[model samples]
Target: MTCKFILVTGFLGSGKTSLVKHMLSDWGESARVAVIQNEFAASGVDGKELKLANDQFELIEINNGSVFCVCLLGHFIHTLERLLDEYQPDYIVLEASGLADPINIVELLQADELSERLVLDQIITLVDAANIERSLAMLARTRHQIMIADVVLLNKQDCYPGDLTELSRLLRSMNPHAAIYPTEHGRICLSQLTESSHLAAGQYYGRQSADRPEQLSACVVRVHQRFTQENLNALLAELQHDCIRIKGFVQTPEDVTLSFHSVFENCQVAAVSSYSGAAELIAFSETLTSKQVRQIVRRYAS
Candidate 1:
């Protein structure tokens, strides 16, 4: 049977590795699987994560800056061909580097010889709930990632307490067709990734609404702070309507590094990662001005 390839991508620190690991666990014994990871670090992270399953699954690592560059396209094509010839697996999964532009990867697959061997199944993008709102406005890559995805998994959800109705409303306006799922630690049903067909040509990318021109200018900020429960709640409550999303990494008085994801009016919070770091907060909204955000930050900083 011809193989179906699912290209997975997300920004740095977005749990792409964890998501792939979980998916492998659920793939069952019936399906033959192969995975290709494109990484920026000299050390291959996915290889180590998938080591236990190495015997059963064919795994290959591409250590390059980003898969989107023409410099690495030749290597990607060569490695892909080699993997297919050796494994003949029923499914192929490619995880692109976080900073890598997914649209370019999709365009590469649409080209000559490579397109013949593998069919584009879906572009599954893992979004960092903590950083997405800000990243979406600041990075074109973020918006482009969402625009091309068949499935948008909003990961690291346990870390924010913002709003969901606004999130769904904004994302819907940005790309109406893609299914969006909120997940904690990248936990989501495998079916969400695979149970859909590739979107038709014209439907792959969608335009943001004119009213949300600010979404085109998304930005992210990470604040590392220890706060009283009331202070933490107050900080987030103030940000709920001010930006697209506010992901909070609050060090509660209880000695827990609490995380939360807020999209508009729907906010979900849970305790995640005990490792302490400055709280990372990402705020994004359509046409958000730097001055406006500075004010929001000052309000919380005080």
Candidate 2:
């Protein structure tokens, strides 16, 4: 059987991980799932959130860059081919990095490597209702994500509590063809996840990878020293900036590991009982360099 390919893309902190988790839990019951988790950071923090059945699903992580970028596209194709050959999964769900430019999806589906083996099932893009306005204004890729989606999920509705009618209208203006749905915590009906997108495979709009900018840069920051919850909050507060997004695991003074999630200047911290990775965060910024992040981390962490 040809593998069904579901590509999930969205901006940072847009509930992409939550949506993927929901899919894995709900869909894995019937279909064999293989997830391609492409993370911009070296640490696959988002992969940790997926609750998988050992026999029902498998995960492949392509980290440290966008899979759509020239930097990782070749590797991405090769990995998919290998997974299809060895695992023979029924569904291939790709959780692309927030910075990914998937405009070349049609070109990829038509590639000599994946054409016969894979079928494009759907292009689901999640829009963080609370942050969509700001993201649309500040990031070009945000518009691209919406423009190419077969189904657009206006997620985090509970957090927004604003005028979604207008928001929906704006999103429709971006892509009149896409089906739009309001969702909270990335919740959506199972049919939406399982149904074929009905989009013509070659119907992709002309916008391609050349339009994506390589302005964003990322680095992993590891802290061996433990911190009180208070210190950890203070440290993130000091470093929050308009150009950056951060997420990963943090070590507590009690030797516990806590998850950290930040978008722009806002963040949410929570304790996790199962985390085992080093207390390191992957930070991405449009203007900050790796050396600069390391210096800032040293100063604030000290």
Model 2 C-alpha lDDT per residue in residues 1-302, reported as the tens digit of each score: 79989999999889998898877768756888899899877777787656421335788889877888877889989999999999999989999988877877878877799999999888999998888987888678788788888899999888886899999999989888788899988888769655535463245645466434557777777776676778778767866762467877777767778888887766889888766656777787777776777677666452
Against the hidden reference, what TM-scores do the models get? 0.65, 0.92
Top model number, lDDT: 2
Q: After aligning candidate 2 to the native by TM-score, how far in Å is the CA of 32 from where it should be? A: 0.8
Residue 203, candidate 2: Cα error in Å is: 3.4
lDDT for model 1, please.
Answer: 0.66
lDDT of 2: 0.79
Q: What digit string (tens of lDDT, one per residue) describes model 1 on residues 59-170?
A: 8888645666666777888777787788888888888765566665556666675777887787788877766786776667767677777888888777756786667676
lDDT on C-alpha atoms for all candidate structures: 0.66, 0.79
Model 2's TM-score against the true structure: 0.92
Q: Which ranges in model 2 have alpha carbons more than 4 Å from their true place?
A: 51-56, 211-214, 299-302
